[model samples]
Target: MSGSPPAGSQQQGAVPNPGSPGPSSPTAGNSGSSVLVHVAGAVVHPGVVELPSGSRVYQAIAAAGGELPEAAADAVNLAAVLQDGEQLFIRTKDQAAAVPGPGAQSGAAGAAGPPPGGAVIGPTAGTIVDLNTAGLAELMTLPRVGPVLAQRILDFRRQHGTFATAQELDAVDGIGPKLLASLLPLLRV
Candidate 1:
């Protein structure tokens, strides 16, 4: 905000460091806290890395040494931004397609919806719902699920643990045989 530019100042047009104080937006969410995160899968340096709490999606990718050629960079909602304790799954095309169904959970951008582990549908990028942690509305995002059924699933989860298998979705209140059949590919826990 100073008046005249300094002479021969080649750094005038340079990009500012994100770490430096510049413009702070009250609504620009990011934790000032710093934490170490493990970045793996298709990344340049697939290992443990440290980053600030509210770093952008791209910043975390940069700290991870950037994405590998096979990583689905386009799939991430980079501009929606990031949060602390978040996991980024830079999944390969083959890796994503191998899941029961990809692109089903579009409710939350940049949140991992595909499972990180091969055995279950992951929170790889979209809304990741823990059967125990989610409320009715949150649970409805799953395929073939609705408010009534989501509540049943929650009640069941409260009485029991996560559904031992997707088959147990049949036990939920409104989940009839046809609905359970419809949900086979989506219900993981």
Candidate 2:
């Protein structure tokens, strides 16, 4: 009885049934509604950062690397309020894309097969990666795709539209039977 809470107090050692939903369960600002935010990129730490309401973009910048020398001064509204899930992009001065050169239309490498020794087919069946959402870096990972061909793939997708079928990649200048064969399994709409 000594371990029990006194009258009018909550019972000692009683576990609150957290699974039960009450009116407060689903309401914002309730005990279950607390959420912390993370900020990265061009900032001081470039890692997890917790912020409360009224935190500003400058705060995240300070948490990262205090901003790179080439980070656009005008890119971020230093005083702007940071949203809970916002990710800020600060471009660097040297991170510019150069114009394409000759062989920009060089054909795709034909029929990329499994690693070790190349073949027309892969050891395990291929899986598709979406071109629409994939970045230039990702497309470059494909076999025989030099930087130029990767850019062309992005440009073609942007000019036309998302690729529904993997076969549609044949539309890109460099993509041929060889390239398509390798890319087929790795593509998704």
Candidate 3:
């Protein structure tokens, strides 16, 4: 017999041919590793984006067609790692001012507790309340949210876990789209 090995057998240290996929190739195991994320606000295309498993916030934004001209880039942590099924809300400069400072939880981290001082600074130095964890008193600070409506919000929260998104406020009896739109800038999930 000749010294050479069989024709179809791989040599000990030889590189695999590029045309054929190998067992360790990226394409071999990447099919189900994609993460689905919802990117909204301040992005040119505000909707769901599919990205690789280890994608970052910046990549998600790019998948959503990049940020809008009015986006508050400074407010976002572009390097933050993305999680599947998370919603990324990019605020505008005006909207960014309404959000609480650095310690506030965002994205898939779950609902943030009330601000330390019970308020966050808005664009004009006014205070904005967090809907997910705000007490009835804090809720009353919102436009048109009086004692009764505030209590209703509290009741709703007690009945159904945390507010996953500000849009959930619509489930509260008295809140509507117009009010939700106004509240959007002054609230956090």
Choose the strongest candidate by lDDT: 3
The C-alpha TM-scores of every prediction are 0.42, 0.36, 0.41
lDDT of 2 by residue, 1-189 (tens): 112212111112222234432221221223543223343333333444434345554544543435655544243345544544434444343321121122222334333311211111111123244566654434543455554676688789889988887799898987788778866777777
lDDT of 3 by residue, 1-189 (tens): 111122211232222233443222222134557666666667666777656567666666655556777877555555655656656666667766664443422112234332322221112225455677665434544555544576788899989989998889889887778777877887877
Residue 92 Cα positional deviation in candidate 1, in Å, after optimal superposition: 0.9
Best by TM-score: 1
91: Cα error in model 1, Å:
0.8
Worst 10 residues of 3 by lDDT: 1-10
Model 2 clash tally, residue pairs: 17
lDDT of 1 by residue, 1-189 (tens): 111222211131132234443222211114445544445556665555445555454554555556667775555444323433434556676766554443333224234443322211124434445554544433543554533455567678878886667787677766678666755654455
Which should have the higher TM-score, number 2 or number 3?
Answer: 3
Local distance difference test, each candidate? 0.47, 0.44, 0.55
Scored by lDDT, model 2 comes in at: 0.44
**Candidate 1 weakest ten by summed lDDT:** 1-10
Over 4 Å off in model 1, which ranges?
1-32, 100-189
How would the candidate models be sorted by lDDT, starting from the highest?
3, 1, 2
Which residue pairs in model 3 clash with each other? none
